[model samples]
Target: MTTQATLTPAKELAAKNRARFPNESAEYRQARNALLAEEIELRRHIERVAERRRQLPPGGEVTKDYRFEGENGPVALADLFGDKDTLIIYSYMFGPEREKPCPMCTSLMASWEGKVPDIEQRVALAMVARSPIERLVAAKKARGWRQLKVYSDSDGSFTRDYVSADDADVPAYTVFTRRDGTIRHFWSAEMSSEMADPGQDPRDAPDPDPLWTLLDTTPEGRGANWYPKLEYPSAG
Candidate 1:
């Protein structure tokens, strides 16, 4: 059996895949075949990028022993890792100045809440916010996020240093690694609106949020006017 490294070209593999619907037109089938070719290339590119990311050299070592308020009490950056050497921190946009959390961030976190147990098996995961611990807890409860461990960056040290320098009401995904008693920054999502293509939203390739992915399969394709909301007024 040929492994992926020795497999046929993506286009060839894509062309070999055949499917037909009851009443689909010939033109539709032809267009779909072309789309499938591109999809196969996209999948290959994603794997290549992931391989490069894993090969990256060590990132900058963390200097500040940032403190955070967890559910139980105060905890340091090192403590968040527990027994795991890697930690993935998601900066929640629920800062003190904001009356409510960012809807986009909330939407992503809601999906992550269900995957926490599976995700934590390899690396530690924590959701950090600039709000006080109590406020963070309240928001978590309100959203019914039971699995995600929430923490408060009460001093804004970690947020400012790793997330944003100005404490912007923005969400960020960052990863850190610990080795030989030294913790170092690993990687973070740096894609921004400035990097977006014309007519496309600035988002990471193969977005972490499953919402957009699921929508991409539909006819509307993640409609521009629609967005996830914290709550929708119930129909009276």
Candidate 2:
């Protein structure tokens, strides 16, 4: 692998960036330039991580033909793949005990609803919850999410096997591949709170949600006490 030093230095690339803002101080520009170099390196690191993920060998074969209760009716694990060879499933933290769906998961899905059509062109995407199908559908309708496909893992077999063995109210993002006549696990967001750095939230490297990405560019940077809510009262 080519090192950043061997290739063009991130500092040099950042130095070449002629972008400027109105009335920015020289000190700010200096600090911004330094930050830009780090951003360049971060971009490179992200690309490397993605390459490593793509290079991963075939994971465990999915032996269990897990069943799910879709809005339409019952569906199998293979049915979620549809015509695509790759499938991405988000195990929502909407278990029966919770009064409402997870706010973080809901925020992520709200962003995903619009991109579903474009994303489904290459890979199938589904959001599965341990709640009943009727409940999941109701929440979907209430949220005005039309593009995302929601499924209910009524038996908890799929959630137990792939998500949490104890049926914990934790969300999981897993990818699976269906090639030829067999299906196998691809990759999963295994990073947990235990692996997180001090003061940093447990999140995947290439975050699936746009909320964090957008906030990261701002000074506040995902406030510690702030979190998405199921519903917000109308300003009107």
Best by TM-score: 2
Query: For residues 118-214, could you state the per-residue lDDT of candidate 2 as single tens digits?
Result: 9999999999999999999999999998999999999999898888989898999999999997999999999989999898788887888899999
Model 1: lDDT to the true structure: 0.90
lDDT string for model 1 (21-41, tens) is 999998988889889989888
Best by lDDT: 2
Query: Candidate 2: where is the Cα deviation over 4 Å?
Result: 1-6
- What is the Å distance of residue 201 in model 1 from its true position? 2.9
